[model samples]
Target: MIAIVARSENGVIGKDGGLPWRCKGDLQFFKRTTMGRKIVVGRTTFEGLPPLKGREIFVLTRKPDAGFEGATAVSNPADVPADAIVCGGAAIYDLMIPQCDQLLVTTVKKEVEGDTFFNFQWLEGFEPEETIEETDEYSVVSYRRSGPSS
Candidate 1:
């Protein structure tokens, strides 16, 4: 599985249930990368999203019976497919990061206040495979797991 996220310099990924920064390039990059793929997200993240067209969405929630429209509800991380792209709201990332073989991260150039943060230490076992300076406001980095997979 691959984990994808956009975070500020201080690791802030969200503020008041949404992104802390407004970077159009990062938004475009996310859409281009995840389009037509299966995406796994936490319930809160799923709820905040606008209509996502052309992608299969799996919402990880304790209440799998809650019946989220237009998305499949999954209770366990094991229920998520190996090829699914894991998106976040922190907790989902924490749960799925261990299963991720790669990480696609967009780092917004500045730090901003947020209630949720991503731990960069999670990337410790991964190595940067590629990095693209998308714009002055942000850059995208791809990290692949180093060494052999267990």
Candidate 2:
């Protein structure tokens, strides 16, 4: 599975359940990487979106009127698409990491003062290769299931 989120140094994922930064490239990387694949998210995450395009999203929540017309709702990560991407907010990442094959993380150089931060071990798989990193605030990196693609 592919999971995405922007976390801070303190592991503070959300304050009132919203992202810490406005990383457009990170968001776009998320969309393009997981496009046509299944996407799983929490209710709060769902409520925070601005109508995504061309991707299948499943929400893991227990709210009423639980459906997005074309999207699916489930109880947890396991109920998400087999190879779907578990899109963020820290809650979803915590639940999905053990089962996810890899993670696409956009680590911003500047640490925003926040409550949630990305887990270092999540990127430790296969020796954690730096697929993409720029001289900018955000560094887009990907880790493979088997580590470094050998």
Q: State every prediction's TM-score relative to the real structure.
A: 0.94, 0.79
Deviation of model 2 at 47, angstroms: 0.8
Best by lDDT: 1
Query: What clash count goes with each model?
Result: 0, 8
Query: 51 in model 2: Cα distance from truth in Å?
Result: 0.7
The list of candidate 1 runs beyond 4 A from truth reads: 148-150
TM-score of structure candidate 2: 0.79
TM-score of 1: 0.94
Q: Tell me the whole-model lDDT of each prediction, alpha carbons only.
A: 0.88, 0.68
- What tens digits encode model 2's per-residue C-alpha lDDT throughout 1-150? 666665544555565567777777767777677777778887887887777778787887765367766678787555677777878766777777667766666665555666556666665553455667554656666666673321
Give the range where candidate 2 is weakest over 10 consecutive residues by summed lDDT. 141-150
List, residue by residue over 73-95, the lDDT tens digit for candidate 1.
99988899888999997999888
Winner by TM-score? 1
